[model samples]
Target: MRAFLRVAAPLLVLSAPAFGQGGPSPALIGRGRILATAADCVACHTVEGQPAFAGGKAIATPFGTIHAPNITPDRETGIGAWSDAEFLRALHDGVGRAGEQLYPAFPYVQYTRLSDADVLAIKAYLFSLPPVRRTAPANDMLFPFGYRPLLRVWKWINFTPGRFAPEPGRGGEYNRGRYLAEALGHCNECHTPRTLTQGLDMSRNLAGGIVEGWQAFNITPDPVSGIGRWSREDIVTYLSSGRLPGRAVAGGPMGEVVGHSLRFLPREDLSAIAAYLEGQKPLRNPGDTAPRSGYGRPDPDRLSFSLGGNGLPTGRGLYVAACASCHGLDGRGTASVPGRPGFPGLVGNSALGAARADNAVLAIIHGVPARGGRGESFMPAFGAASRIGNALDDAQIALVANYVRAQFGNAAGSPVDATSVRRLRLENGGRSPLVVGVWAGMALIAGLAILFAARLVRRRARGNGAERMP
Candidate 1:
């Protein structure tokens, strides 16, 4: 549900310094707009309060930061100058107009499956936008990754450029869903784990993955650790509205996906996506015993208070003062005023009941915004940077989160600590240790190669000296 769309619609990496030609019909442009929305192109290509598709947003990865390039149809700074063939090559071959290899951050590997007509239609839509004369900043990448030539090797082993083919026996609806999920949606890019070369790990596709410090939980149909219990309606409801009441609510990057992309999609497309996801092979995370939303109940004690203070308040006191107003003393939420959906109940909320407390902690720190089709649902921030009067420090936020989980979620084990809070605050989420280890191993190999060369030079020098002496 996260980690999508900056390099969407191919951004048509320009090869030559020439402007686009001819005018496209309104129908074609409209179709392109739908495709672009499906791809969530605006999320990555547009910065907040900036011209859409002007593209200076920074995408973070373990390797470094990649700024989404200017995709607005400005001849000098954007893709306005790209030819149709150049646009096609960029999307299908992961190559820039100048024949430079594009980083996988643009997602051409998945896009390579797009039909030629679909690719061109997106281009037509982009060309229709008013040209923004803006340029994207240079990428700030690590030593090895900055060298674009290395992408050739990465793509060779991991990429297979081709159009999607429908299954012979399956009906058109199933194939349509497959096309939307695999080609247009590219859900696996975030939900699926990655291989050593940072490519999608297809063997355990959609089992689960992490992005930007938040876990994009398993979408497979496993009874445990995945969405086995989520009916097709539940999936569609969550996708379209960003909440399933007592189940899950969208937060972090998932919230962005809902607000920017999925909400705008047609109901049928949402249903199709749900169908495709439900049909995926069930894969389980090792320790999960029940559904994430099945734990916790209404608190028995409604009226209780403690401050534990030497000028410091207890978690219960904080919750009572700030949280209990909207979410009741028993943790059942109240209705909102007019146009908005009111505060969500903490009990039976997936964020609280999940094995990892990352989402719950993040919600307390950053606050949730109005997203999906759910009304103007909103929460205020309580982190260090928050301007609100009720803002909490790392230690305080930890206390509140732990208290909520214990009292309502029944998730009784290791508690969320302040150190973990600080790390998440720094935007350093859980990256795969295995990937880090691989990089370290490569560095060790390079060092050994250098040592061997030095030893050989010394041995030859000594042999020549001995021969001269004799």
Candidate 2:
């Protein structure tokens, strides 16, 4: 009877209803929707022109490409077949259905901190989406790393499974902010630098790291290299709209984050994030002694023009012709007219002031699209396919970018070259040499273990033979 009950118990649990068995309550589904938005699941899961959550987006990592799986409710290709236990396991343990270990690229490390209730809520929300029958492309990872079983070792070393608990004596706002920033938002995944093993270096949390070829600027409270100088209002404004005049504008991944995710967040939630960020310890990059400064004024002599024999416009001439109309010859932006806000000032702009010139080059190549609730002022792209601006080649774009940096950004001696422009234009993904080294080290350890095991076996066999002879 005991044995029968045990077997029956297992069957009963399997047959039990999952989170959204007979359709979740409207309030529960709404909560789940909010959580999903906060998590920005759509950003990673959805491909352009495809049904939401019917994933085919390719997330590039230092190791390889990880194609996001369909999360739509399709029984064959999406999460429709996933049980509550299976879905929760994916969130809490980073394990997929069929007991397959999921890659960290899915950020299960952060999701692991979510409570059971939260996980179920998210699952319920996902199940509410119209199921699409689509399968994502397979991951294109390099050798050894490509082996999914290797993730077991990776998880064992880096992953710590648990739910987030609020710190004692902290205000509600602070705690809420911590949960949102660390768990729901997974801000550290990109903002914080990775260890040699590609784990988050929590010791230097939010001090800044590179992602996708663009600098994820430091958000720590350090006055020199971080956001220490930013007011809470500044942070909120930036988060709400993705722009802060005279400070910075969002681009690349950040732009997408703003346009799609952050801008939609409520004011109180934005405030919470700002509060949490402000409370963090000030961290600065190595050798960053002082705050960055903008160039006071552009020198007239520096704007001298000299055309190439090929009749291509000189850097100064190009700026004068292509840029100076809106951004005056003096490099100060023109005043707003009846409809437009005119051009943004180049001097002291964050993109121009950055240590690396990639952002500046990207802006010149791709141009700033109209974003947020901001009116229709837009910067036309100068790349090959630009409809408004001259379809300048790599050399011309580099020339204009370097000239702006030197004259308006005080980066006079350090110039961006054609080669750098070409590279940035072609390669938007950053490489991870550390990931390669980790794989190599793992191989070495495995080899040594095998050799040691063989020696032990040989010694045991010899001992057994000696015993028989004796």
TM-score of each: 0.86, 0.85
lDDT per residue (tens digit) for residues 1-470 in model 1: 22112212233322222233546776667667888888788988999899999999988776667899888899999999999999999988999989999988788878888877778878888999999999899998654667788688788889999987776776555666677778877888888888866789999899877777677888999987788998889999898878888888888888888888888777777786787787789998777888788888887777877669586678877888878887888888877888656878888888887887888888888888787344676777778465568568889898888888887784673588898788676553323344445665664664578679889999999999999994
* Highest lDDT scorer: 1
Error of 1 at 68 (Å): 0.7
TM-score of 1: 0.86
Alpha-carbon shift of residue 24 in model 2 (angstroms): 0.7
Alpha carbon lDDT at 444, candidate 2: 69
lDDT of each: 0.79, 0.77
Query: Candidate 1, clashing residue pairs?
Result: 15-97, 15-98
Error of 2 at 334 (Å): 4.8
